[model samples]
Target: MIVAGFGWRTGANLGAIRSALASAQQGQPPVTALAAPHDKLALVSPLAEALGVAMIAVSPSALQSSPTPTQSPASLKARATGSVAEAAALAAAGPGAWLLTTRHISPDRTATCALARSCTEGPAQ
Candidate 1:
């Protein structure tokens, strides 16, 4: 399964979220789900619906253990993750998942996206 994860600032609109995901998805497999912090489900729900993919709410505890390729001071300070987008994707993709891209920022700079692929190939919830 391929998962696309997002991290966004307050007031980020659907356009910004979509732009970031598009940028991150370049050369990647089709995304089966969208993910975001459990506390921030609203951040990714709209995009998930627009993409017609499943939504995965990642827990803070899960983010804590998932290592990311990129570091964002704000993300690290606020969520204990080097990159919220990367961490969310890795966590939601489950065991043995690896990032396909680090993070891609939206044109508006209000959102970011990262992609990760699961080790297993069956359907994902």
Candidate 2:
């Protein structure tokens, strides 16, 4: 299904997301996922294996902690974040690929449910 499963640490792009969905519908190839960055391995490895999807790990060591500001910033810097940069690179390489979110929607809807949603293209909620 070309499901690119990832986490909040895993960046997703609209182009890639669309591509993954199209590829899944076409059934021309297995879902292509980008493994979470190396630092995120402890988190994404098991989930990726459980889903049984094809993934290529790139710059796994690039994952680092980022802080989200709750208050308005004095300046609007266009600096891109971690996974977002990865997703952009992927988008450049291949458009319309879906990058799965690493963040869980809920406790019950973890690995399996997320995978199901990718396969079924239905809401996991």
Candidate 3:
């Protein structure tokens, strides 16, 4: 399964998120699931509905525990992670999953997205 994780500034519109997700998924497999911080379910729900995929609300601890290739100073200080989008994608993709792309920023810089592929082939949670 392929999961796309997201990170967005407060009040960012769905268009910004869609743009970032489009960049992240460029040339990649179609995403079967979506994920974001547990506290940001409200922000992700609309995207999930639009994409017609399941979405996971990953905890902050889970996001912090997941290692990512890209590091962001703001995210490190605020969320104790490198990139929330990368970490959420890794976490949601479950064990043995690997990142397919690094975080991709929206044109407006209001949102970010990353893709990860699950080692096991099946529907994503």
Candidate 4:
């Protein structure tokens, strides 16, 4: 199965999921996701409709983040915690689990580390 994930930012994840789905050699259904509330996922309705896939939000806290239009400490913490949790969850999933996040992850970032771990541990040779 071709599994993919998306972050709150709409465009990037939508395109990534669509590309992954399209590139699959095996016939697999594409699934899109919202970072938080189910209602928020509706924002991507057009993409969902276009891809013929449904959007699902994981956890409410997952949507919270740091770095607002103006940056602050609390915002930073929120972003860090939420990102860490999100990455951890994705890492725990099975192989071929394509986790596409809209957040820009650095090389040593938590999300990046988690994705690397998940991809290595989950996917079967």
Candidate 5:
């Protein structure tokens, strides 16, 4: 499965989320699920519905353990991770999943997106 995870600031709108997802995908595989930190469920739910995909709420502990190559001081301070989008995508994609897109921020910089695919496909290209 391919999962797209998001991280966004308060008051982020659907446009920001959609823009970030588009930037992350770049004509890649379809995203089967949308993921975000549990606290962000309210924000992600609408996006999931719009995308017609399931939403996965990743736990704080899982986000911390998921490795991400990028680092964001703001995200690290808020969620104990450098990249919430990347960590959430990896967690929701389940064990052995790897990142296809690290993190792509929206034009407004109010949201970010990351993509991950199941390990069954081997390492992410």
Candidate 6:
């Protein structure tokens, strides 16, 4: 499975979320699931519905524990990671999953997205 995870500011709209997803999916595999910190479930549910994928709510601890190569000062302050999008994607994609896309933010910076592929799958056949 490929999971796309998101992180967004409060009051972020569907447009911002859509833009972030578009940026993250460029040259990437189709996403099979959507993920975000549990508190952002309400914010991401619409995106999940639009994508026709299950939305996975990642725990804050899990997000913080997941290793990511990118980091932002603001994200570190808020979630103890450089990029919540990357961490959440890694955490939700299950053990052995790896990032397929780094965090991509919308123009307004209200939303961010990252993608991860499941461990059970190899590169595209």
Candidate maximizing lDDT: 5
lDDT of 5 by residue, 1-125 (tens): 99999998888888998999999999779999999999888878987998799999999999999989999999999999889999999999999998998899999999999999978767644
**Structural similarity to truth (TM-score) of each candidate:** 0.92, 0.34, 0.94, 0.36, 0.94, 0.95
Q: Write the candidate numbers in order of decreasing lDDT.
A: 5, 3, 6, 1, 4, 2
Off by over 4 Å in 1: 122-125
lDDT by residue (tens digit), candidate 4, 62-114? 33432112233442464444443233224333333444332333222212111
Per-candidate Cα lDDT values, in order, are 0.89, 0.33, 0.91, 0.35, 0.92, 0.91
Model 1 per-residue lDDT at 67 = 93
- Model 4 spans with C-alpha error above 4 angstroms: 9-39, 61-125
lDDT of 6 at 100: 92
Candidate maximizing TM-score: 6
Q: Which portions of model 6 show Cα errors greater than 4 Å? A: none
Inter-residue clash pairs, candidate 1: none
Model 6 Cα lDDT, one tens digit per residue, 1-125? 99999988887888998899999999988999999999889888988998799999999999999988897888899999888999999999999889999999999989999999889887654
Task: Please state the error at residue 103 of candidate 6 in Å.
Answer: 0.4
Candidate 1 structure lDDT: 0.89
Better of 3 and 5 by lDDT: 5
Q: What's the number of clashes in each of the models?
A: 0, 15, 0, 3, 0, 2
- Taking every candidate in turn, the Cα RMSD to the unseen true structure, in Å, is 3.1, 11.4, 2.9, 9.2, 1.3, 1.1
Candidate 6: lDDT of 87? 92
Q: What's the lDDT of the predicted structure labeled candidate 3?
A: 0.91
Give one digit per residue, the lDDT tens place, for model 1 in 76-99. 999988998999999999999988
Q: Is candidate 4 or candidate 5 better by lDDT?
A: 5
